[model samples]
Target: MIAIDNKLISDEVLDEQFVCDLTKCKGGCCEDGDAGAPLEDWEMKEINDHYEAIKPYMTPEGIREIERQGKYIYDKEFGWVTPTINGAICAYGFRDEKGIIKCAAEQAYNDGKLDWKKPVSCHLFPIKIQKSRRDPDMEYVNYEPREDLCKAACSLGEKLKVPVYIFLKEALIRKYGEDFYEALEAVAGYKKNND
Candidate 1:
């Protein structure tokens, strides 16, 4: 583990190679999870504040789920999360013509209706962050490799020579700021040279 700025990063983040192979996975992460996308307290407010703008891009069922469930729901395990339609696809998700799950919030952002793109948790997928149980202030950011869902991504990443840290640069910067990302890059470079 690498400690940086109150966050502990798992070494797998530097060693592994991964770039989302959306064409192969078809955004399965949005639909495959038992609970909806995890939302931070602030993100819950963002969703409520911008629901109207995001509503048009969502499916009717998604809208209904959000209306009935009040944007998010509490999971016994996952705490506050975006509500899912029929306990499946997220309340903010809709399928594209190719059957790929797409985020309505992202669509709204793409259309310039909102500044926030999807939930930060969703945006930083495959890289999960957990607060330290003891310290609370410290976080552990780790690369979680799901072989079944991410095999194609692994293959593509290896083919393209993109490490997990590099592949997730945008999301990491979004979560931890540019300075943190640069620090991580420095760590990656050092590891590469030393190994």
Candidate 2:
């Protein structure tokens, strides 16, 4: 696990071309079973609203099953969390008749009907948010990306136009500090321009 400071990242990294090839990964992040990154009050509202709007599209049995599992409970000791709905498969994920796994929120995004603010948790994955006592600020931490998780992030990065380095930096800074970020920047530069 790596901690990253959100302030250390420059806008250049945010706009770079870091692509994730998801077709090769098959939604590993969705399968890792952890969702609901720590939410601020506003973020919670957004998630609740999105859940209400998307509730109709979900299978009733699926919703019941998730409820039965107590997936909605927020535990202070464990932090804001939820069990993966549908046996660790995302509720929004499904197979088409041809057997291609699809993400409903992504499809909605493509159709231009989805609220970008909704599902705030979906955007923050693998990278968990933690509060910093040193700076008294919130920080993002990378909790060991599974091989498949990296692939899924690669895919989402392509769709969202975010670089993996940005994610990495954010995670690193939250867990470490400016010096760590500088070290990572040097390493990243070496990798980018190496012979």
Candidate 3:
């Protein structure tokens, strides 16, 4: 584990390679998980504030689920999360004509109708955060690539020589700030030189 501030980043973040292969996976993470995308308090607030703007971008099923669930739900196991449609796809997710799942919130954000893009949890795919075992307050950055859904990504990453940390640079900076990302970059440089 690589410690920085209160977070312990798994070595897999440095060692493993990954890049989303959307054509292959069709955004499985948005629909295949047992729970919807995890939501922070602020993200919930954002959803409520921007629901009207995001509504038009969502599918009828997604909009109905959100309307029925009232933005988000409190899961016993996962704390706050976006409501899922029949315990499946995220309430904010829709299948495009290509059959790839996409986030309504992201579509709205891209069109300048909403300020928030989507949940940071969704942005940081394959890198799930957890509470450190040694210290509950400490965060753990875990690289959790899926075997079934991420096979193409893993293969592409290995072929391209792109590490997990590099692939998620933007998300890491968005969640943890510039200093944290720079620290990871520095560590990657050091390890590359020494190894």
Highest-lDDT candidate = 3
Model 1 agreement with the true structure over 1-195: per-residue lDDT tens digits? 999989999999999888898899999899888799888999999988998999999999988887798889999877899999887788888889998889999999999999999998888879988888799899999898677998999999999989988888888998899999999999988988999
* Model 3 clashing residue pairs (backbone): none
- Expressed as tens digits, the lDDT of each residue in 100-167 for candidate 2 is 44555455555665554324444544444455557756553433445545665556767876665566
Better of 1 and 2 by lDDT: 1
| Candidate 2 ranges with C-alpha deviation above 4 Å | 1-18, 34-40, 66-71, 75-78, 96-103, 133-135, 141-143, 148-163, 166-195
What CA RMSD would you report for each candidate?
Answer: 1.0, 7.3, 1.1
lDDT, residue 103, model 3: 94
Q: Candidate 3, which ten residues in sequence have the lowest lDDT sum?
A: 128-137
* Overall lDDT per candidate, in order of appearance: 0.90, 0.51, 0.91
lDDT of 3 by residue, 1-195 (tens): 899999999999999999898999999999888698988899989988988999998889988887798789998877899999998899889888999999999999999998898999999989999875688889989998888899999999999999999999988998999999999989988988999
Q: Which should have the higher lDDT, number 2 or number 3?
A: 3
- For each candidate in turn, the TM-score is 0.97, 0.54, 0.96
